[model samples]
Target: MALYKHSAYVKTSTSDEFDKVYSPGASTPHSGIYRCEGCANEIAANQGNPLPPQNHHQHTSAQGSIRWRMIVYAQ
Candidate 1:
């Protein structure tokens, strides 16, 4: 993992669609595991129906760039 020390606020628009998600116990689990095609997130279906609750970002990676839009050079 790359270590970044800077953060910025983003005022942007995105068209990528996010798949529907459910809380740990919100979905009907099965005898097998289920994975998300979009982000590769997984649902432990073996944990029993409506698998144990989990955090949304638990199985995902955080993506963003920390770049300087305005770097003051010699004026």
Candidate 2:
């Protein structure tokens, strides 16, 4: 099998939602990073669930820009 770099963020509005997308002891390990559909940025993990709005930011990309945000979370 070929090794692929896994780099993606999980978007969720609530803790329950996050849990739904990711479960404990799941095969895919949680990167502790959550991406916001509003802005694309990397936020520090362990910031706690239901991350504060102040933690998000607008990330820029070559293909225009997106409002995706990210934060680290426990697995």
Candidate 3:
């Protein structure tokens, strides 16, 4: 499993001129929690932290253990 912290995530307000929105990242995060983009729930995480998903899942990047950090928008 990989590792990351809360700081790995970044937030934004709006999307592009069309429908596609993008956030650029040159490097991957150290370690943190990852949530499902579908259900918006913790699907995987590393270490015995307070984060949910009690156990690790097959979900994650193959490049390395990075935060799949979920984005939450305020309505």
For 1-75, candidate 1 gives per-residue lDDT tens digits of: 112255343222332212333344544423434444334444444323454444344443443211111111111
> How would you encode candidate 2's per-residue C-alpha lDDT over 24-73 as one tens digit per residue?
12232334555544433443334324433432343456434332233344
lDDT of 3 by residue, 1-75 (tens): 233467445444464322322222312222333444323344333333333331333434543332235333222
Query: Best by lDDT, which number?
Result: 2
Candidate 1, residue 35: the lDDT equals 46
RMSD of 2: 10.9
How much is the lDDT of residue 39 in candidate 3?
A: 35
> TM-scores for all candidates?
0.28, 0.28, 0.22
